[model samples]
Target chain A: MKFVIQRNQLIASVQDVMKAISNRTAIPILTGMKIEVKNHGITLTGSNSDISIESYIPAEEDGIVNVEQIEEGSIVLQAKYFPDIVRKLPEQTVEFEVDENLKVTIRSGKAEFNLNGQDAEEYPHLPKLQTDDSFEMPIDILKSLIKQTVFAVSTMETRPILTGVNVKLNQDKLSFTATDSHRLASREITVKADGINDLNVVIPGKSLNELNKILDDTEETVEISVTNNQILFRTKHLIFLSRILDGNYPETSRLIPEQSKTTIHVNTKELLNTIDRASLLAKEEHNNVVRLTTLENNIVEISSNSPEVGKVTEEITVQSFEGEELKISFSSKYMLDALKAMEVDEVNIDFTGAMRPFIIRPENDDSILQLILPVRTY
Target chain B: MKFVIQRNQLIASVQDVMKAISNRTAIPILTGMKIEVKNHGITLTGSNSDISIESYIPAEEDGIVNVEQIEEGSIVLQAKYFPDIVRKLPEQTVEFEVDENLKVTIRSGKAEFNLNGQDAEEYPHLPKLQTDDSFEMPIDILKSLIKQTVFAVSTMETRPILTGVNVKLNQDKLSFTATDSHRLASREITVKADGINDLNVVIPGKSLNELNKILDDTEETVEISVTNNQILFRTKHLIFLSRILDGNYPETSRLIPEQSKTTIHVNTKELLNTIDRASLLAKEEHNNVVRLTTLENNIVEISSNSPEVGKVTEEITVQSFEGEELKISFSSKYMLDALKAMEVDEVNIDFTGAMRPFIIRPENDDSILQLILPVRTY
Candidate 1:
């Protein structure tokens, strides 16, 4: 492979593919980044057991040449040094050349690097996932959907299926659900899925997190395709593929409480800050649990005690309260995470009882719901 | 004790003193921050075995009131929670009240934190060092001096004295020298010490690093007092006290070669970048050693080889070169650190031979000097 490429474009594409590269991969060849040169552009691929990423730099786009002197070939270079070498190159353009013996030479300005390249044939080829179910959504919306529900996924591997977020598409409505049993987060968005099959897949939370990092917050559309085992998130010039978890996701619709005995609407930021301060002392406790109590005159008291470290209490007036007076304790960390995910100014919380799970959602919208299982506290 | 203080000021002061507090201290009381209220101001103190810092918040300054409703008393609060609590308080002003039993109540807006406070009497008081061996210098210069030399201090505790930077004052010149026995960094600045006594002291590199972090880069004068066991750096509202390391520092002045067999004057940034790229493959080696070979026409080749990772060579043209041609190998990290600290456009490097120590100094200035011993390589 011989190509002279714009350093900035190469750096950007290398960083994008690097997200999927893992040094701890069991497959030795997977640790190297595969570079394939073509007349159209150059493609870089990096992969681990969970996800694989391919980023492309077009030879010419908008009359600007990103790559030239292209010789159609392929080589795999060590991921460790290739990225750093490209990043620190002295000039705006870098030239890459590979000989038949697999010796790769990278030159820029007066500097030159001779690296022993691995045979590209040894690198596992990511099978082109053949699927008819494909849909498009704005990149920003996809990133938001991932962020809102991914944090609630179970970090513990005790239930391996719970480590992934459940994505279900029923006709035009697309929803994501994540739960670790202690807390749950769900968000829904409407997508034009005309002629698309009813899709149900669970993507690993870790993979989603990496995808989010690589994706820029733009309104550009991203085409998503799902297969029996692999899911692909394809942009204009980049492709992200993640393996689907092999298990049946639990049915979570019935877990939502039918009705609430008490409900309160509060400013999202005020409640978040109060819980954060209260948790300062609660951090040493079992779950960093803090109790919320309804008081007279639409006011609620949030308190936490660590006996050895002292206690904290904060009273915030809610926008509205009704039904019954209640005292409930839940993990402050869970509440904080849930509050942060909701970008709305006001959130209404519905409580079934002290011992049951409660739901928090935007006061005006039901699209985002955060549910927390209250701790049994005296 | 009771006082209402501006949240911003309180937060800044707390952060400053918290630098001295360590949870791993053998003395339990040192883990708590001591707050003492006086008529003129309130003082926050945090101490570990090596250092203690006192940050004072005056009642009023420059017609602005930072603290009000001050009642005289003192108490020690857990450092872990106090800083976080103050940072996340709900209001612009935080009111603090302490009872006789050391129950501390902190109120901000509708939020309140009741924390258990320790007796101030139990907190070990930092001894006020009595010494006439004192002088003043611009804070920015002092900070620069520390940064230029402190990084060279030995991190290993095998020779504990080498872990501290040798600070010396003779007549009017104040110089700081640090070395790990392989590479040495030394910087000097002139201070007004006409009446101050000559002094030599070794200050722990860790403490100096913390002190540098707490100090803002300003031209304001910092009064420094040196005693046998402790050194004091006092600014307008902050006093940083660090314990002086016991033992005499080894003489390092003789290590710098007086005559050079080869000298190369190069752009500091160009050489730094060249060394950085050359070190990419060198990182897998023992000391990240890179070779510099002077060629004809003032061209110098920088290269490194990792048997398994391949090699890199970059030839950079120097501005000027004199004396005999030379080839030397040294740690790229040490060279990078020295170049970054200089902040100069060009540097003159003097080499005695391939095996002896070499010196790098600014082209037209001698205030800062960096010396490195070449590594044995075939």
Candidate 2:
């Protein structure tokens, strides 16, 4: 295989595919990136046991030539040093030539590198995902959906299914929910869809994070196809495939409280800062718990005390307060994560009781909700 | 003790003293920062076994008030979290008040932090260095002198003295030299002095690095005092004291060749870039060796070949070449370090022969010199 391509274009494609490559893969060939040259363009593929990523660079896009003198062939090169070499190449354009024995030669300016390439045929073939249960959503919306719920997924392997975010689609509405038993995050949005409904799939949170990182912030559409055990996300120049977790996601709707004994509306930034300061001393304690108490005159007091490291207390004025006065203690880290995901000036917090899970959401918005279980402080 | 200080001033002073604090110090009190509130100002001190740093925040400097409500007392606070707490305080001015029992209360805006403080009596007292051997030099020049030679210090602990930079003063001239036995770097400058002649001392490279980090990049003069076993560097708001290495420094003057068979003047930047690119493949090999061959017509060829990873060659045009033709190989990293330390547009390279040690210096300057030993390539 022989091809000459623009350095920037190649670097972009390599980075996209590198998201799926991990250093500790059991399959040796999986650590290499498969590069295939065709008449139309070049495709770079990287895969681990859980996910596969393919990024394509067309011969010419928008009247700008990205590749020239292309010959059709394929080889897998070690992904470890390929990205660094391409980034540090001297010239704007780099030429890659592979002989019959898979000896790859890369030349740019006056510098030349010959890297040993493995036969592409040894790479595992990605499963062909074919299903009518597919939907399309804007890349920015998908990225937001992943960010809002992925952090709540359980990082422990005791319950493997909890490590995946439950993605469910019914007719025109799509919902994502993740819970680590301590905290839960859920987001829902109306999306344009096609042939199927009542579809449920649990995608590993790690895979979703990698996918979100590669997705651009543009409003372009990303076509998502779901099969029995595999899901594929296809964009114009990139394709991502992930294997679904092999167990039913536990029902989490019952965890969120429907009624509240106390409700308060507060500026998100102000509350976030108060909790951040209160957590300083709390972090020294084992549970990292900070307590919030509603006082008279619509004021909320946040405090944390460590026996060995002193204490911290912060008072913030709330926008409004209603119902019975209440106090709750929860993980400061969980509260911060929930607050950061809500992109709003004001947030409405609902407390059921002192020892129950409470829900927080953007004021007057029902699309996204975060629930945290309060820790009992003796 | 009680004082209200500007947040920025407190942050700056804390950062300056933090250079001397390390978590792995054997002395438990060294892990804490000693804060003394005096009639004139507040002083913060951090010390490890090798070095001690004290930074003072005056009550008023240059007609600006940095502290108010000062009460004379002292306490030691844990250095691990002090910097973070001060940086994240809510208000522009932070109030620090210590109770009779050493309970420290820090208040800013509506946020209040109470930290447990240890009695300052347990903190080690800094030694008083009253010496007639003293010198004054621009802080910028001192920083430059440290940077020019510190990189050559041996990181291996086989020879402890080689891990320190030998600093000497003769008459009014100050010189600094460092070497790893394989390569050497030296720099010198003349400075105003008093009662210091033929004084030689070895300062640990790690201490110099920490001291260099805290020094401001201004032309303001800094007072330096040297005794038999201790050295003190004092600026307006900071005092840094470091213990000298207790061993004889081997003579490195004979390493630099007095004669040259071939001399070439080239742009420092071009040669650096060429060697950087050539080292890409060489890095994959163990030695990281790159060879430089002077061709006919004032052109230098830089190349490196790895048995398993092909080869790379780059040709760079030089300003001039004299004497005889020569080819030499050396560690690319060492060459890059020597080139970067020389803040000059052009550098003159002196080569004795293929196997002998070579010298590099700024085209017409004698203030700094670097000697690098060539590697034997079969």
User: What TM-score fits each model?
Assistant: 0.98, 0.97
- TM-score for predicted model 2 compared with the true structure: 0.97
Q: List the residue pairs that clash in candidate 1.
A: none
RMSD each, Å: 1.2, 1.7
Docking class of 2: medium
lDDT of 2 by residue, A42-72 (tens): 9999999889999999999889999999999
DockQ (C-alpha based) per candidate is 0.89, 0.70
lDDT, residue A72, model 1? 92
For model 2, the DockQ equals 0.70
Best by DockQ: 1
Worst 10 residues of 1 chain A by lDDT: A127-136
Identify the candidate with maximal TM-score: 1
Top-scoring candidate (lDDT): 1
- Candidate 1, superposed: residue stretches over 4 Å from native: none
Query: Given candidate 1, what's the lDDT at residue A314?
Result: 91
Candidate 2 per-residue C-alpha lDDT over B1-378 given as tens digits, one digit per residue, 9 for 90 to 100:
999999999999999999899999888889999999998999999998899999999999889999999999999998887898999998999999999999999999999999999999999899999855677889999999999999999999999999999998988889999999889999999877776667799999999999999999643988888887899999888899999999999988877788999999999998998888888878856478999999999999998887666677888889999999998999999999999999999999999999999999998788899999999996
By summed lDDT, the worst window of 10 consecutive residues in model 2 chain A runs over A279-288
